[model samples]
Target chain A: MKRERVTLRFSPDAYDKAITYHLVRDYGLVVNILRAEITPGQQGNLLLDLEGEPADITAALSYLSSEGIKVTPSERQIVIDKDSCVDCGACTAVCFSQALLIRAPEWDLAFDPDRCIACGLCLSACPVRAIHSKFSDPIEEAPPADEA
Target chain B: MATKTIAEINEKIRRGEAVVLTADQAAAMAKEQGVKAVAQQVDVVTTGTFGPMCSSGAFLNFGHSDPPIKMSRVHLNDVPAYAGIAAVDAYLGATELSDGRPEYGGAHVLEELLRGKAVRLRATAYGTDCYPRSQIESDIRLADINEAFLFNPRNAYQNYGAAVNSSSRTLRTYMGTLLPKFGNVNYSTSGCLSPLLNDPYLRTIGIGTKLFLGGAQGYVAWNGTQHNPSRPRNEHGIPVGGAATLSLIGDLKAMSPDFFRAAYFDGYGASLFLGVGIPIPVLDEDLARCVAVTDHDIQTTLFDYGVAERNRPSLGTYSYGELKSGQILLNGKKIRTAPLSSQKKALVIAKQLKGWIEQGDFLLSEAVAPLPQQATLHALNSKDEVK
Candidate 1:
């Protein structure tokens, strides 16, 4: 059994299909969607954690691919420009994940990326344009051409 | 023993023998060495603050051009400036926004001016004999200007209250974005390091007192706009929250951009994060003890911005140290806390002031008249029309 956090992008035609229902019934998987955006006959994106047998999850991905759906890993990180950041702590207020906080005594900002979900809400909250989102591109982040 | 005088301290500064410590250091030393001993040992206690000071502006005297005209209407870098004074003199407030962009304001213009950048100067007026011109638009740098002086009507608040949102909606405020429904908290004071907070009583800091103003030598010009000395205080004589403020004056050309940063509130207008440091000479043991105060000893009420009015409901009182904890327990819920003022910059200013006094480059002045101890701020009454 395995659990993986994945991002699924559905095309206009794929949006109408009951993929979530299929994952639960046919594949016997527990699909927990963290975030979702769907527009029937337009497009859709779902951030989900699929809990099922390793082989079954792989089969489900192939099924999604056959349905003209794209499967990708959800790997997002928040990057803060220390020099530009005035330490105003504007992002910390909207940070539901508690990744950004002020240090004690001196009152300096501290960022814990491990706790951050990379919700990207704080990006706009920052007045100085210091906070940013760094999405890991699997195509580029893969092993270098020479190393491979 | 005769009370120590500003002249006596100035003599020590002249001799390069003045002893100076930060407000926190003075208070800590007083706790250990006692106020009397510390007072006799230390010559000065420096106080500092780096916060978003909105009530600040600079009066610039633009050199007359080929076709001199009365600048009845003036704009500096697209930001409007008050030009009612003379043909070329204008007052650019810190929060006045540029016509193109609301976030860009006089603060940014002044900061650019400090960096020796040229600002757009535009004006319109009726032609006259001496100044016979209807319109004038030109680029002017700080050096091109005849004179520029910063006259902040209010800064260095004695002790300011903290703010929190208790209502169900997120409140966008100049206090930094307050989280909805008391989700978190925000404060705007440098606490123990603040000049007025240390003096609290306005004892040593007064008109004519020289200070480290925005990285240059300046003076306390007058009492700030809201000089509420009669406000409530704790047993230590320090006002509990929001009392005593100082109006300051300094040459804008002598100011540094490092001590001043332009701030744009998410919803509110532009404001300048001004850095000001004042050296308080310990004239007596009582004054020494007061300067020795710490963050734990000081307290300010938290206000809920949920109420849309001049008077907001007070949540509770918390010490600077307690508020610095990053989170506070209110109504059984842990509310996160944030600060708009920078203690890092405040510490740097305090250290810089201490070095200036040690180098004999800065001198402290005794308050000619202590700030009003009984003055109350009253709302203006409407005059009934006798028609």
Candidate 2:
């Protein structure tokens, strides 16, 4: 079976109702309500495992956009930053992806790269703020890994 | 060149020998034996207001303008008194013995099935009636007295891996949608909807080691609007508790197997009719083992029964002895029997079917076998006496 991966950033305000009809309903994916972290006033990331034709993915995006969802191709295939990550543990606490972790000292906070969907969730999750997204390049770099 | 007789099968079963056959072998044997076969059946029987509807989650949503969702009835009044009779008839072309003598050759078939005991039932009233939540619970308790039952929690929930949409463009292929979303995750859908959709239910049946072992989540709900409320003022009152949701995630962090171990290597069993597309003899032994395991890992829950506050499990334990020996359920009631085997049904069936197919006699085929000869003979005898 063919499958595609896509991430849509829900406006931080897209709360309960958005979770119901949009992400979970239209896409057949479940967004971790608990793993979400928004920077006081910033867009939140919704990772979706889209299965079907490329047209279907585009259709879902169009529907979401029309419904007032702010979606963009995610950057930074990896979620966590090795440097400046202090291992302070705020990212892990807010991460529903279970992608980021604070193991300890210099070696603790490692990005699983494989588990990271590049939803840019860690950007807001990080207390020290050291994560970067791929979209900021204003163009395409490479399709992210199929991990998440 | 000689096919085994019922007596020989019985002897092997009596001696506790393994019953084995591949689906091809079972089909060939059944064809040679002249037994009919039917595969993949869904029989939904509802006692009250709710009927089977397709939604990934337990709770269904209704718009005020949308009519009330009523479940249609599914009946199984004619299911053979015993679980594997269809397979037995299909295998040896012989009827089940009312005399209680063990059908030894295929005893394993009767032994390996994972027959459901605790039949969970849940319903919520949307109109004028008092939230006789107690009565709904009472009916469930009564049903529980008759059979093991399940009721969704007090909230409505949707299926996590389901795609619900109004347009054709949204119709993602079921197979395509399965993996990207459900693949690599250990998840259990609410009682395989494939059966309801007239599709094969056990198609996804396999071991945790064979498929992705996703983590398990429980108590998922969906809240949707209700129509025809007795109190017009409370028009916005949405109904919950319409469904139950659970997810199994397959990941290393969970220490679960990434691939569900490939078992039941041969033959196919439909979750709907709980029928297998193989020789009756092979299916019988396979199902018997499945039942034994199912009998073991069982529990039941009912609210008015007040079992929630109690330590009683989800489905009760196996206790077949009290239920008229041959009759598994007494008036639809379980007797807390013990599992005849150690492994689950899928595992046992997988092993037995694989073993059977390796032998030359096994076959895989399909047909709905005729009613047992004894039933025919008894009817003929009664008519003769009357004449």
Candidate 3:
């Protein structure tokens, strides 16, 4: 089984389609919605964790692209600047997923990107402005290829 | 009971025969070999804490300008500094926020200054006969300043309560963010390794007491603001909650940016993360017992920050042992716990202070006077308004 994390951005026009339902029923992919920001008639984004055969995941991605849904790999969503972090564990107060933690005995702050759901909560909790979210700003689609 | 004086310890230190240990090490040793035995074997016990201390700032003397001006209003990098004193002298408070940016404030400016970075200095003054220049703006580095000293009014709180939210909404506070329904618990102070907790009675820590402040030698100037030494204590004489505080003074020019840092809470404001360490002389069994406090022996109250008032509701009392275990039972539910204070850095400070004492480079000081053991907090009466 193959597991992957990806961000799905839906334009306003793609709001009516049942994206998650189609991915599960047609493509035979298991979808876990890590986070979602969807408002009716407005552009929305979903951070998802997909698990299935590699071929099935690829087919789902192609299907999403055909529906005009932008897919970006969610390889690293949270970035913590080690030089600025004081290991105070303030970010852990808001981190429900336990992605950011203070290791026992040593008391040093450790971050696990795999556990992070990209909630963007730690970005504000950091005192020295050390934590940042790549998805904090709205994802913008690439400009249409210039007509020849 | 074995006893040792500051002078005697200093003598041993100079002779390279003194035995120094961090509070953690000393506490463990005392636990294994009773207080009396440990007191006879150890010469000094050092304690340290690195946490958010909002009541901290620096006083700077920016030397005279070519055309001098009695700076009535001063700002360092847009954060206002109190310039009501001398011509070029000003005090920058850690909590002072900039006009445009709330996150960037006095603490950030202080950190920048310590990093040896040039900061924008702006001041305006009423024209005078001897100092005619009304306004001046320039970039100034820490090297350019004649003198810069940290004169914090309050720091190294003896013991503080853990904060939690019992309400339905999240609250942003200096204690860090608290989730609703006791979703998480946040506490500051280095517990067993905390300077004040180790010297709970203020015996070895008082006016003239030498200490490691932000990587520089500093002195206890006075009893810090809101210093309530009369706070209720446990069997060990340690306060159950926030109690005695210290007013510290140190040379900022010798401070390291590593120990002195700027911090910001999401919706709250800016504050300084200060590293403070104090060495306690093993005067006698009493002093030795005090410094032997451990996480299990020290107790702190958990306060509900959902109230949003000076007096918050207390959830319950728990030892540092339970809190540091990463979770505590509140209302029969397991609530995850986190610390706003950096325990790792506090240990580092304690170890550094121990090294200095072992090398005979740092010596203990006798307090000039004892801090008051009886003091009460007075609340402001809003009805008494001046006409």
Q: Which stretches of candidate 3 lie over 4 Å from their true place?
A: A9-22, A38-44, A58-75, A138-148, B384-387
- The C-alpha stretches of model 2 lying farther than 4 A from their native spots are A1-148, B17-144, B148-170, B173-348, B352-387
Q: Name the DockQ score for candidate 2.
A: 0.02
- lDDT scores in order: 0.81, 0.26, 0.90
- Best candidate, TM-score-wise? 3
Question: Model 1, which residues run further than 4 Å from truth?
Answer: A1-77, A119-129, A133-148, B1-3, B380-387
TM-score of each: 0.84, 0.22, 0.93
- What lDDT does candidate 1 reach at residue B200? 72
Identify the candidate with maximal DockQ.
Answer: 3
Clashing pairs in 3: none
Candidate 2 residue-wise lDDT at B104: 17
Alpha-carbon shift of residue B11 in model 3 (angstroms): 1.6
- Tens-digit lDDT string for candidate 1 (B186-291): 8888888888877777777777888888999988888989988888989878787788888989998998877877877778888888899988888887787788
Chain B TM-score, candidates in order: 0.96, 0.21, 0.98
DockQ of each: 0.39, 0.02, 0.75
> What tens-digit string does per-residue lDDT give for candidate 2 at B129-156?
3221221211111111222111121111
DockQ category of candidate 3: medium
